[model samples]
Target: MKQHTLPALLALSLLVGCSSSEEIVPDVPPSELYSEAQVSLQSGNWLTAIEQLEALDSRYPFGAYSEQVQLDLIYAYYKNDDLALGLATIERFTRLNPTHEKIDWVLYMRGLTHMAQDRNFMHDLLNMDRNDRDPEPVKAAFKDFKRLLERYPNSPYAEDAEMRMFALKNRLAEYDLATADFYLRREAWIAAINRCQELQKTYPDTEAARKSLAIQLEAYQQLGLQEAIERTTELMVLNPI
Candidate 1:
């Protein structure tokens, strides 16, 4: 009886192990997998698209549609709001296919991904300003867009990249100006002046730069530094409000 019981237990354990760790692998060819992925993409089923694309990639790593699979996965990840994985995929694609014909597209996608993830998700409902949020993500997006422009100046995405970079610049300048204003309100004259100076110098063409100069003038007056006040007034004259 003991011998029979031990063999049955071993058989049951094997059965359980087989069921528990079974992978959901498709038996169809890579071509069919890619087709299913495309169907999912067209239907806006990003999670399904990601799954099929990943299946195709694993089954046929060097298949004809391998590159497209990677690209589509990045887009799918973005659409699914899986931004971290999207970024990781982007990094892998860039590192692996640095000289790919569609590298510009990849770079543009990377910049777009950065922008998408940086969006202030609660800002609309909370009536919050985007510029009031942390600036690191915006700065990252700006840098990525800049890289795309420098490396692929004539690419189809260059215009959009430029537009995004312009918006990011304004936001960054606004953040710096806000910091200066915070200091000025607290009567931290030197800190406020430094913030204003850095904002203007770093983002000279932004609208906030002009505002920062105004803040600088106020900080100077508060400190009663006559020479600094005169110099700041001259700057304001040149900026014309």
Candidate 2:
């Protein structure tokens, strides 16, 4: 009998602990939730803003503020460093509202989000070469910026997008140069020359174009291609030093 009583007591203690540990967040009305989310955003409480915005969106999918909520969610997700969520939100918004007047802004934000994700704090702090890292996100941002410019040439965000695109183009060219250098080190002259030629064709005005031309010349010399070397030398001379 004493053993049975001890088991019952232990079960009751466990149940009490579980009940006390449960978190209880009060249910907020959609309007109140949105207001609270706005306050959180203004206060830089990204997590709280995300929570409230998500709740409002879930509760009032087609409410008066639905479109605005979606846009805000994208920005909030970006600020919270949830780049995947931010990009997903942007894609959904653009797909659903293709003709929305503020679509350019969405594209700009998408580009910014991609750029943020691509950023390497360690590389920046250590002055590491960006070309040595992954280029996918940089390429993604470049595409987004380019699309914005093509679709909305007169957009208020056009100038900034263009500037970012220029930088991204150069970065991409530098990546190709880096790869060419790697092939050159491995003595794969043909592969190195291909990469350099591709870089020159794709990013003619990039600073790396000169280096790529030089690499092509070196690869041609390494492979003992006299004709190719002469052609590359002429092209290199035509380009700025």
Best-performing candidate as measured by TM-score: 1
For model 2, residues 60-170, the per-residue Cα lDDT tens digits are 889988888999999999998999999999999999999998899999999999998888888889988768678899999999999999999999999999999988888
Tens digit of lDDT per residue, candidate 1, span 38-79?
A: 999999988888888887878888889988899999999989
The superposed Cα distance between candidate 2 and the true structure at residue 174, in angstroms, equals: 0.6
For residue 34, give model 2's deviation from the true position in Å: 1.5
The 0-to-1 C-alpha lDDT of every candidate, in the order given, reads 0.87, 0.88
Model 2 RMSD, rounded to 1 decimal = 3.1
Against the true structure, candidate 1 has what lDDT?
0.87
Best-fitting candidate, measured by lDDT? 2
TM-score of each: 0.86, 0.85
Regions of model 1 farther than 4 Å from truth:
1-25, 237-241
